[model samples]
Target: MADLSVNFAGISSPNPFWLASGPLTNTGYQVMKAFDMGWGGAVWKTVGEPVINVSSRLAAIDYGGRRMMGLNNIELISDRPIDDNLREIAEVKRRFPHHAVIVSLMLASDPTLWSDMMRRVEDTGADGVELNFGCPHGMSERGMGSVVGQVPEYSQQITAYAKSGSSLPVIVKLTPNVTDVRMPARAAVAGGADALSLINTINSVMGLDVETWLPDPHVADRGSHGGYCGPAVKPIGLYMVSALANDRRVPVPLCGIGGIETWRDAVEYLLLGAGAVQVCTAAMHYGFRIIDDLTEGLNDYLDRKGLASVQDLVGKAKHRVGDWNDLRLSYSYKTVAEIHADQCIGCNLCFVACDDGGHQCIDRLPGQRAPVVRKDDCVGCNLCSLVCPVPGCIEMQDIDLGLVETWRQRQSRVGF
Candidate 1:
């Protein structure tokens, strides 16, 4: 069997899948239950001075049959007392000795407060600590979350404080609210962080309740922007992870988060250079039992690929990622839309899309039997192929143009 276990920043876990800090890890009971159900690790909900969350703190975006495609939350950190959380952490670690238990911490940027909290949490026997500088809403307003994370200097300073206060490995969780993610990532590494995790939710507002003329999840007919997560944020997370992973300047293990719901998603993150990954919304929507299929599916995939362990797959695709300028301008793949005679229903969607939006490649009228791809006008953009409802009905056939020269080579030959 391929080994799914991973050692992320010196904190060894049974596998790369860890329950991200959120509603899922808010209590010892929940954490323990998740471990029992096979989650390899858990980052305890962000702990700080207790908070009083509002009644309507969560709002979601649903697309037709898909519910919770994107989730927004105005919720704060763990509202439980610090002592109670510490006690639970101690107990959970004692019981699940082999599992990774990382305590997530957040507080004002005061060095003493951060250092003291780090020291106190380290005493709980947890595997490591994740600096919660990524919360984008409630905590940010309080000057504790993305308020500090958005500033590279503040992130570096807080990371230093955590490192100073504890010997335990420190993983700095980053917010995606900034223009450039690499700046903060480099800052965390410079401040002595052993590993990095991202992305904490993006700041967003779900739709407004147009009938009532109020924002969604309104407390009093008005709602504030909140942190957004779920499947919609996966692309953003993958882009940031790939950007950092490809940058050799910022060297630190990454625990990818945001919109990871399955084994395939986990594999994508790992191949993009994440040492491991964390999940929140999936566990929030489904249950911790999702880990069963997540693990089994990943294991099966690795076996089929003849991989010995999950570690072997990490960063496998990192080198393949490149800057836009590095792309091959010379290589050309000209494919034209080909319609299957027997399969065409003459929906005319392809013709309409191509004529109005694409290269006017497909020729069809209201009573036409089928859409024909006009070879000369076809740019091979595949727009017609995409809007077609039936699968295999519209196929893009490649046009083999013999040896080709790149723009760069052609420019050199002209010698401007």
Candidate 2:
């Protein structure tokens, strides 16, 4: 059998699927249930000084009427008292000794406070601590969360404080709001972090209310920018994960978070160099039962691919990622749209779009109500193929260019 287990930063879990720090992990009941449902780990909802969240704390963006395509929230860390969260962590870790229970924490920019909290969490027998420096909204306003995450100095200082206070491994959760994620990633490594988890939500406003001219999730008819998560942020999260994984200065293990909803999504993160992956919104939208699909799909996939374990798949695709300049400029293929006479509905949508927006390569047939691609004028752009209503009716046929050469090599050959 393909082993799905993972050991990220020395904290071994039955599998790489972990519940991210969010509403889903706010209590021990939720964490325990998630473990029972086959999640290998859970980052306990971020704990710190108590916070009072706004009445309307969450809003979402949809695509084609799907719910929660992108979620936005102004909520802060755990609203429960610190002692309560600590006690729950102790209890959950004691009950589920085999599962990875990582404590997520945030605090005011005081090193002493951070260090003290780190000490308290270490006593709970948790596997590790994730510094929650990435919450982007309410907490950032108070000099916590992404405020610290946005500054490399603050990130390093706080990470150092956490490491100094706790013998357990330290994982720094990074925010994506910054211009360059590598800056904070390097700082975390410099401060002795054992691993890094990212990316926290992005800064966003989830559309506006036309009636009041205010943003959605308006509390008392007013609103503020919130942190965005869910499926929409997966690409951004993957990009940041790849960047950190490829950075020489940031060698720590990575726990990928943000918009991971399925086993396939988890595979993409692993192939891009993540040691483990965390999930939130998907579990929020569906239920913790989704872990069934997450684990089963991954296990089946690994077996089919003839891999021994999930670790073998990690970072396999990293080398394939390259800068735009590194791309093969000379690789060329000419594809022309081919129309099937039988499948053509004579809608002429493809013809109209191709004629006006494309290279005007499509022509109406003289006798029939069908259109044909003018092969002489076609540059093989595939505009007609794309706009065609029939699926297999209009398809692009590739014209082999016979050779491939990079622009750099071509320039060198031409003596440029």
Candidate 3:
């Protein structure tokens, strides 16, 4: 089997999967249990000043009978005392010496406080300290969390403070609520972060109780915007990770987070340039035992691809991501959707979708069950393929007219 171990920044793990900082890593009991279940690492939930949590702190967005497709929470950082958390961290590290034990921290903007916290965290024998600059809800209102992450200068300054206080690697966790994620990312790098992890929970209000007319997970009759995460945020996470990977200024390793549920999802993050992948909602939904499947599936995929190590897959697809101007504009280069009669279930879902939502390039015969594609009018939007219930029923065939030209080339040719 291919080696799945990864050395992210300076911390080595037996595998690339690590439990993200959240409710799961709040206690030593949970962290130890996760290590026993085969997780390679665990970032202890954000620790700092204590705060009381609301009775109703969780909310979910369910779709198509699926529960928690997206999870939103008003949850704050670790409410446990700093001393208790540090003691547990030390013990967990002693018991599982090989596993990566990282501590997530969020505090006020004071450099002394940050430096002091760093020194205390390092004393716990933890492998690294993750600056939790990305908490979007409760912490943000207090001039911390995403507040520090949203501003590039603050991110850099705080990271420098942490670096000055501890010799251990510093991983800055970035917020996704910003208009340009790269801004803070570049700032964190400037602050001397050894590595970066993102994207922290997005700001969102889960939903409203129609009957009560209150927000979801309301405290009594009031509701507030909370941090949003889960499967819904994967696309955003992938885009941000790819953006940083393609950037020349930010060269540090990336730890991908947001909506990773399966090994396939983890592989997608890896291919985009994440040295390691973090999980939260999925583990909360399906128990820690899922680690078995994650490790096994990733190993199987690597061996099948003739890869000797998981690191080989990192950034393999980064070059494939680029701006629209870089895309081929050649008229001869085209792709049209084709339906396989053998695989077609005679379901008109694709035909309906294409006619209504996409280009009207599909037609149904008077008596035929399967729809035919109009090659000339087909735009290859992939809408028909996406709506098809049967896999492989609709395939997009690329047509090469023996020509290639990009928008940039056309601009130069026009000499405008």
Candidate 4:
């Protein structure tokens, strides 16, 4: 059996799965529930000088019939009192000492505010603090959140301030809105960030209704650009994490964030060099129960792959990545699909589609037997692979188009 336990920056968790700082971690009750549900740790939501959050501060995006798979929010940091948050953090840590109860915080334009907040939160005895430099909406307009992240100088100075104020490890949570991610990343490390967590929600607004002319979850008949997170943000997050991990310029422990709902997503982040993977949107949308799957699923994955621990997977993919020219240009493949006899109902959907909408690649008789794939003419565009009822019924295969440069040479010689 593999040991999933990890000692990250002197903070030990049973695993590398941590709930991110968001709506789900807004309180001790929520954090406790998440811990009970098997999350390795939790970063308490961004707590500021008691905020006055607005009514209906959330908006969403729907694509492919999935609602809130990608979420947007205008919600500010924790609207609760500062002392109350600290009390809860103190109590939660005493009760669940094994779990990493990280305090997340955001505050005003003044250095004194940052200094005071870090000192106050540190008194709670939390394992660490993640400076919220990456909320894309609401707070950004006030010279905080993503606004702070966009300016490298601001990030550097504030990080230095936070480092000065905190006794615990200070993890700078970065925004994705910067021109180049590495620039801000470098600034944070330079200013003394103990660790870096990245890819906070992006700015986005969902489409509007046609007849009503109002965007969904209407906020006084209008809505502002909100922080976007969830499945949609995973790719962007992965790219940022990989870029920083692979870059020799930035050398800080990374806490991977953005759109991770499952263990596979966590594994990918760790393989790309994250010490831990954080969840925000998934917990907001699906509630804290998903942590069970996040933990057990990763355990099963480790067992299957013969991985002895979570650290074994971290940065595994970094070495495999190559420069542009190092990529194999000679390798080529054509799209192909193989139908499963058991899964196929012989609906001829692909046949009709190919006949009318696509190239004449699919074959089916009007009133005949099972629709059969004609390999000779099948271009492997995967149209048939889609519209199939059962998963794996139609498998997409890449057929060799065969030596493209050689074909070009023959054609040139014959002038064909």
Candidate number of the best TM-score? 3
TM-score of 4: 0.84
lDDT of 4 by residue, 1-416 (tens): 67878877768888888888877888889888878878889999898877787777777777889977778788889888888889999988888999988888887767788788877877787998888999987788777899989999989998888888767898899999877899889999998988899889887876678899887546787777888888999999998999999889788789899889888898889999999888888877888788788888988999999988888998999766645533323234466667666677777776787778767766665665456677767776677767676778788776665755444554565663
Compare the candidates by lDDT and give the number of the best one.
3
Candidate 1 residue runs with Cα over 4 Å from true position: 365-368, 397-416
List ranges where model 2 is wrong by over 4 Å. 330-402, 408-416
Writing each residue's lDDT as its tens digit, candidate 3 over 1-416 gives: 89988999999999999999999999999999999999999999999998778878989999989999999999999989999999999999999999999999988888899888988998899999899999888888899999999999999999999999989999999999899888999999998999999989999988887887999989998988999999999999999999999999999999999999999999999999999999999999999999999999999999999999999999999899978787886485888999987788887998999889998999998877889999989988899999898988999999887767778877898852
Higher-ranked by lDDT: 3 or 4: 3
Which residue ranges in model 3 land beyond 4 Å of their true spot? none
* TM-score-better candidate, 1 vs 4: 1
Q: Write the per-residue lDDT of candidate 1 for residues 1-416, one digit (tens) a residue.
A: 89999999999999999999999999999999999999999999999999998878888888879999999998889999999999999999999999999999998878899788988887899999999989888888878899888999999999998899989999999999999999998998989999999999999988886778898778986788899999999999999999999888788899999899999999999999999999999999999999999999999999999999999999999888767544344244467778886899878898899889987777775556887887877888888889998999999887666655555555676752
Ranking of candidates on TM-score, top first: 3, 1, 2, 4
Error of 1 at 65 (Å): 0.8
Task: Rate residue 273 of model 2 by lDDT.
Answer: 95
Model 1, global lDDT: 0.90
Provide TM-scores for the models: 0.94, 0.91, 0.97, 0.84
Considering TM-score, which of the candidate structures 2 and 3 is the better prediction for this target? 3
